[model samples]
Target: MVRKPVVSGMFYEDNADKLSSQIEDSFHSEFGPGKLPSKKRTREIFGVISPHAGYQFSGPGAAWAYREIAESRPADTYVMLGISHSGFPSCTSLEDWETPLGTVKVDKAFQAAFMERSGLKQDETAHSQEHSIEVQLPFLQFVNKEYKDQLKIAPIIISEEQRCKEIALSIAETIKQTGKKAVIIASSDFTHYGMNYGFFPFQDNVRENMHNLDKGAIEHIKSLDADKFMGYIDDTGATICGRLPVAAAISACRILGAKKAKMLQYYTSGDITHDYSSAVGYGSLVIE
Candidate 1:
């Protein structure tokens, strides 16, 4: 079964040519407060945390992470851990995903291996309308344009935060024993602030407070402290959409021997819309 694109026209361009052009533009665009990082050859880039908002808002940040992945060329398979916005079950899907660019084959072999080890169910309902993982496909397609057929995906929706460590261990063990080189991607956006998300912890210095809140979570992620990441989220009630997924990726990356994580870019929708009244944060990071 092929999982059709649900947010194509809404979150990104639906036309093939337009979508490709938009992605290429995003790659060429400057990110953060400076020029994007120059591409450098690196070894063993195991994981990345990428935002899943619209291409116009989060695309530059996403490009920074994808550019790093393109430079490293870590693996043939990408394990995508996405938050379930549709409130679906926590599971993995073994169905090809359709995007404006083309269809990305599902790595059934890897999915089976992971499910066997983790005891997670295989369900497509969880992925039916989820946009988090879907939005990242175009970037991967553009980055791997030369080897599009060589790329495969294992998409997993994370619903249970408490099971993250166990799931990560199982995934790590499966990859190690199978000798399959893979990269993990956590799809998340940070701190939905203002009355929109009802997460108003501060009335003054809203932008500064949001940055500090998100930075605290990023610090735990950079440290590869999964427990601390989760604890920080729970204690602060941070409105990070993919805290569980990020924690799982951190745990898996730690098990895969990844030491340091580098923040590629950080910004919010407010930066784009010039409306800080209601904002959502986005960040890009790579674990090595």
Candidate 2:
């Protein structure tokens, strides 16, 4: 089974040539890394935190994470984590994911193991409307030459925030049992501000306050402290779209021996749209 691209031509380009060019431009964009990913991969990456928004608004920020990923030693599987409708529970899919770049197979071996170990169910429909996971695939396709055609993912759409630590333990154990070198990718956007989002924590000095707000969450994430991260979210009502998945990622990374995380990039839609009134904050970080 194949899950076709859902956000193409909107969140990103529908045409392959143009989409590829758009990604290239994002790498060189003023908000982006200002250069392409390196040809060589010598570093090791345990996991990453990426924002899942339209390319124009969050692509540059995402490029920072992908640039580091592109240069890291490849993983046998990328465990993609996303958030679905509330109360959906954590779920995985066996269907291959299709994007403009092409289709990437789901690592069924890991999928089965993750389910078996975590007791998470397999449900394809849960991912149909979620862009959080789909948005990261093209970036994966764009950066690596070695795994271009052979890329594999273990796609999961999580909904239960309370069971994140338990689910993460299962994932970490599954990776160890299967001997699959893997990278956990948690897709999320931070701080959905403005009246549109119904979240106005601060009225004045948004540019400064927004950074202060998200940086607090980033500090917790960088320390790989899922408790503090989620606690911060609860305390502040940060409006982070995929907070649970990010918590899972941080938990799993910690279990997998991730020492620390480093912030790769940070920007707000206010910075892009020039409308601080209603904006979302995007932050990218790598756990190593």
Candidate 3:
């Protein structure tokens, strides 16, 4: 029953009514394709990689994945691996994510398995204000009606560490061992823009390098090559905060017999707001 509020009212609407409507509107707005291959080629998805930014910025990209989930309506459980902004030393942190809609329960059985597999301690304190995962709930409420009562999540907050892959692999293995229907959601935002975020290598320009960098990294992800992905991160220093989660999800999908990934949508806030000086990148990808 421990609930965390994280990025409430800032990343998303705080009010339930407003949040619900906004998410619905965003879901309806997704259209067109991107640098990735057509979605018509990929199989049904086991899960998705989505941005956790505000509704105005990344909501549409996030919705493409959720919309696929809604249309398919997969069963079993959901495990959301999100970035830990708390700077905790923990390899993985787990807790219940709360929003105006309702509390999404933690699947205790899966949680116990994850704890044993990852050997990571639970820190409810870290989950209290971690926005990365919590922001996705309102969209879930919009997409999945069955989620209202049965929704359960294994919320894991990952940190930057030498053994990130070890922890990620263990968590993924635990999910596989469960032998139940489930979906893995990775919450992440690609590239923070402007000097305030200190990653202005492009100097607020809408050049192709920014897009290419993300495309290359995402290509590695699509191939389910975690080692190559880690190498890319080391080489390019791409500013994706949820790399760990995406890595874990890709690994888990491969283990679960998922063959490939398809990019559903990609966009930057600049495309919507006409402010290239500072923008956050958003993308949606699915593994089948």
Candidate 4:
């Protein structure tokens, strides 16, 4: 079965050629790596933390992460962890995903193994309307065009941060048993500020404070301290959308022998639109 794109035209270009061009533009945008990805791979990456927002707002951040992955060794599978804004319970979908560029296969064996090991429920309806995971596919297709047909993903929706470690360990175990070279991508957006989101800590210097808030959390992620990352979220009440997914990625990547992480990009929609009144922050990172 195949899951159609839920936010294709709304969040990004829906037409095939237009979508392809839009993705390329993102890679060359000012906030992006400022260049197209190369085939040379110097290091290995195990996980990625990407933002889920309209491509116009979050694409540049995602471009940075994808650029690194494009150059790194191509993995057979991408374990995608996303947050369903609909508040669905933590679950997995065994459905190939369709994008404007192409269809992404689902690693059914991997999904089955993970569900058995982690007890993550299988539900296609959970993924039917979520944009978090869908937005990343075209970018993946662009970067891995050489192996586009081989693109496969295991999509999981995370709803509880407390259960992140347990789920992550199960994912690590599944990967070990399957012997598939895999990369885990946790999609998230950081620090949703403004009264619109009902999260306002400071009255003055809103823009500066926003940067500081997101940077604090990024520091913990770079250090690979999942506890500290969760604590930072709690202590500050930062409205990060995919906190659970990121926490689980930290645990899984660490268990899989990833040493350190690099912050690919960090900026807010305000930076893009020049309107900080009601903007969400976006951050991109790679764990290696």
lDDT of 2 by residue, 151-184 (tens): 8999988788777888899889999999998999
Each prediction's whole-model lDDT (CA): 0.87, 0.90, 0.75, 0.91
Runs of candidate 4 exceeding 4 Å displacement = none
Tens digit per residue, CA lDDT, model 1, 57-76: 88888888888777876477
TM-score, each model?
A: 0.95, 0.98, 0.89, 0.98
Error of 1 at 162 (Å): 1.7
lDDT winner: 4
The per-residue C-alpha lDDT of model 1 at residue 263 equals: 87
Give a tens-digit lDDT track for model 3, residues 130-236. Answer: 77888887776666555578877777777755656776677668767887678888898886666657777675346466677788888988888877887898798
What number of clashing residue pairs does each candidate have, in the order they appear?
A: 0, 0, 0, 0
TM-score of the candidate numbered 2? 0.98
Q: Write the per-residue lDDT of candidate 4 for residues 1-288, one digit (tens) a residue.
A: 789998999999999999988888888998988989988866689989998898999999999989988998889899999988998889999889999898999999999999999998988898999989999889989999999878899999989876789998999999998999999999999999998999888878878999999999999999888999999999999999999999999889999998888898999998888888898999999998
The lDDT of model 2 is 0.90
Q: List the residue pairs that clash in candidate 3.
A: none
